[model samples]
Target chain A: MNPPTPRPQPIGRLAEATGLKVPTIRYYEQIGLLPSPPRSQGNRRLYPDSAIARLRFIRHARELGFEIESIRQLLDMADHPDQSCADADSIARRHLADIQSKIARLTALGEEVSQMIAGCRQSSVRQCRVIQVLADHGQCLGEHLAGSVKINEK
Target chain B: MNPPTPRPQPIGRLAEATGLKVPTIRYYEQIGLLPSPPRSQGNRRLYPDSAIARLRFIRHARELGFEIESIRQLLDMADHPDQSCADADSIARRHLADIQSKIARLTALGEEVSQMIAGCRQSSVRQCRVIQVLADHGQCLGEHLAGSVKINEK
Candidate 1:
């Protein structure tokens, strides 16, 4: 008789293969980011190879700084194979722009920080240039924190 | 008679000058980040020029992404004018290294994201290269993750 074919993965094996901890995998399932896998006779979760792939995709997207909501949309798009990737491109472009803006803001902030530290000059609190510059709002040449303003509006 | 000198700031004006809301300014005073200013006849808080300068210094340090604790240290150092600036320099260098490391990590992540997006050819889910790449953990070459490892020892 032919040898019996190997069975598919159990939950623990799948977690090990995917480098995801067991609890995190369960959390993903609980959050609906992952589907509930079938159960074996012992009531243990049994995951197919497909589940491993999906988990990998989620992990990669998260690394790219895609928010959970954005990842959800990407996954939904992936479910429909024949769809165009215009949405994906747009999302990626937007994320890139966001990153660029953040870099710009941080760069400007670095300059201001450097100046403040320079102003300290080991002076007494009464004569500290750092304190003087901060008190004068006009000394701040960068943007007036428009992003925080929007958050406050909410 | 000599002309009347300008009066020192009241709490409300100090808050406006420092870009801190009134409640936050009061909270700082409560927490000792700011000193309790003298009170007016109606019991309103009154601040002198030194107090205003301190508020400005705190605000600027915050903008530089210095933690409240670090700012407290810097302020303490500033209180003693005659000390060496070595402590201040060390703090700034540490903060600079942190920023540089974050930028490096983000840049690496951005490259990975660009690759993932580039791999998408708008094909059906069954034929989606992006999905294929995401689903397999062994295929990932980047070390991207949502959470950081804490190095606290028991």
Candidate 2:
């Protein structure tokens, strides 16, 4: 005979098992990344073993910096095990390229800021290189930060 | 006698001069980065010459990735030119460190993704290295992206 079905888990238990916050799991469901699970008589969500695997896949993908949409595509491919893995490979490659470009931009920005600080005389604000360069963009070494580079917030 | 007062310009002119969108200019005003300008008889916002300089300062600081609050502090320091520029130096130093850290994190993440893609045999989804590593975190090279890394959205 076939093995007995594994008991379904409540949302809390599923969250604990998946190492995802409850809100994040809910958000995934809201965003349609996670399928809506069957609910119990008391209206609590009940997840089966497959749900556990799916959530783990999402969490690990997120941890790896996969965007939500990419995670959705990956999930779709995972569900259809017979399909070719070309899309998955392409997505990973694209992500790697994106990360590399960001690294380049940040490196340039870091150098500019570093140089600005290095040139600071630490005298009055009027003579401060940091303030002077910021006040007059013409003083910048280059237009390295001309676009929407994600400079860190204080 | 002092030079003739520079004629006041409207919001649109200010936007054109600063290369900032109208909504962005309004947002800066709302956030108190740009002080509210007096309105004309028709209720059009009229900005003085001093406003142009202040808006440019805000725009440059934002392009360099300074947070709004930090810009406010910088503006205060700029207004008081006699004060020591130690705060500006410190802020630039901190931002430089932040960018450096992000570069390191992104570099690690890129390597992991690169390795994952490299190892992929381009076979069926069932055996795909990209999918496999995402499904199981244990397969990752390291915990480089375990936290809130800003992976790009598709």
Candidate 3:
């Protein structure tokens, strides 16, 4: 006799199995990242076993800082196992480049802030190098740190 | 006769002088970073020359990646020139530490992504290390990248 079909797990079980918040799992569905799961008789969301792997993949990618759009492309590529992985390679490489660029900028920022703090004498605010350097951008090491470079708000 | 009073400049001139967008200037005022400027006879905003210096200071602090709250503290310190600069020093040090931590996290992420791409042979997605590593978290270098460590989403 054929084996009985595996039971579909509820959304909470999927969230537990994948280490993703329930809202995040729902959000992934809303964004079309995850397929809409079938519902039970009571109208509760039920996810197939395969949902665990897919959600885990999405969570891993997000942990590594991939944007939602990029994650969408990655998931699409993942769905087709026989397809060439050149697109995935490109996305990963581009993301790596972005990570490296952020590291470099943060390095520069760290150095500049370090220098300002080091130059401080703990004296009055008027003589504080930190305040002085901030007041006069011309005194900065370079203008590269001037505009769009923002530290992660989190 | 007393010297003539200096004419207040319009919002556009303040924007031009600070290299900050008009909305950003208005945002600073909305957030109390900049004092509200007097309106002209035609109801256009007219800022005193002092606004330029104040705005420049805010811009520089922001360019250095200081938080709005931190900038508020620094501005408060700057306003009181006779105060000790210990607070400014502490803020800079803390910011520097935060930048360093981000640099370290990004470095690790870059390495992991680089290794994944290097292991890929341009083959099918089924054999792709990028996909394999993402699909199976157990195959990753470590669990540290599995949570909160996000590459700058920008």
Candidate 4:
């Protein structure tokens, strides 16, 4: 007897099963992270059961702070299970290093800001320590910490 | 006699003096962080000398990781130098707290990633520790950390 075909799930069910939003699922398909699934007779997207494992992998990597590009490479490695894990190991290492660098930078910033606040006497703006330091970063202990704050938002 | 009219600086000179790119300067204006400058007879922007100090303040605040909304409020406080510094102090305190929180999060992420890499044996993908942890987050000690890695980029 032939093996029974796996049941196909609708897009909403896929989103629910994966803890991913409907839009996020569509976005993943658009980005080619999730391959286009076969559509239903009514043109609804129907995902095979395997998509759960794949989406979970993507979500898990994202939580671990992996960049999309790195995740893409890792996914590719996952697809070809026989490939050496050196590339995956390297990608994780690089991400760890990047995280460490950011921690160091942010720690310095936190120190400077703390110092600025510590010096404040709750006085008028004319003599506010916080304003003074922000207005002239020269007063900051780590003037070298100057850079775009955009890192935390991206 | 009235004070001599402040020298007007062209867009290029303003950019040079402030270390702000011309597009950034224009963007600041467009976003209302900067007031629109009067045009010269040739319809070129003519920024007053005061723009230098203003832009410097914005740059300093940005470097310190103040969000645009907070910077707007701080700028208002700076404008009214006679106002009590309670708002500025609170903003600085809040920012300091935020930086510390991010440090905590990133520090945890760094440790987890480091551990994942450490456990990796540089073996075949089938036995890769990193892949195992990523594919099955159940293997991770902190399974709750599954969230966006976009914090570091921001």
Q: Write the per-residue lDDT of candidate 2 for residues A42-83, one digit (tens) a residue.
A: 999988899888998997777667788898999999888789
Better candidate by DockQ, 2 or 3? 3
DockQ of candidate 2 relative to the true structure? 0.61
Pairs in clash, predicted candidate 4:
A150-B154, A151-B153, A151-B154, A152-B154, A153-B154, A154-B153, A154-B154
Candidate 3 TM-score over all chains jointly: 0.92
10 residues in a row with least lDDT, candidate 4 chain B: B145-154
How high is the DockQ of candidate 3? 0.65
Q: Which residues of candidate 4, in runs, are more than 4 Å off?
A: A1-6, A147-154, B1-6, B146-154
The CAPRI category of model 3 is medium
DockQ computed for model 4 against the true two-chain complex using alpha carbons: 0.61
Candidate 3, residue A129: how far the Cα is off, in Å: 1.4
lDDT per residue as tens, model 1, B41-150: 98888788788778877776676666677778778877775666567666766776666655656566566556666776765555555555555544545444434621
Tens digits of lDDT, candidate 4, B98-124 = 898888778878888888899988988
- Runs of candidate 1 with Cα error greater than 4 angstroms are A1-15, A37-49, A111-154, B1-14, B22-32, B35-51, B118-133, B136-154
True contacts kept of 2: 0.80
- Tens-place lDDT digits, model 3, residues A41-98: 9998988888999998988887777889998998888899899999999999999999
Q: What TM-score did chain B of candidate 1 earn?
A: 0.77
**Tens digit per residue, CA lDDT, model 3, B84-118:** 99999999999999888888888888888898889
lDDT of each: 0.67, 0.84, 0.87, 0.84
Decoy 1 TM-score against native: 0.70
User: What is candidate 4's CAPRI-style docking category based on DockQ?
Assistant: medium
lDDT order of candidates, top first? 3, 2, 4, 1
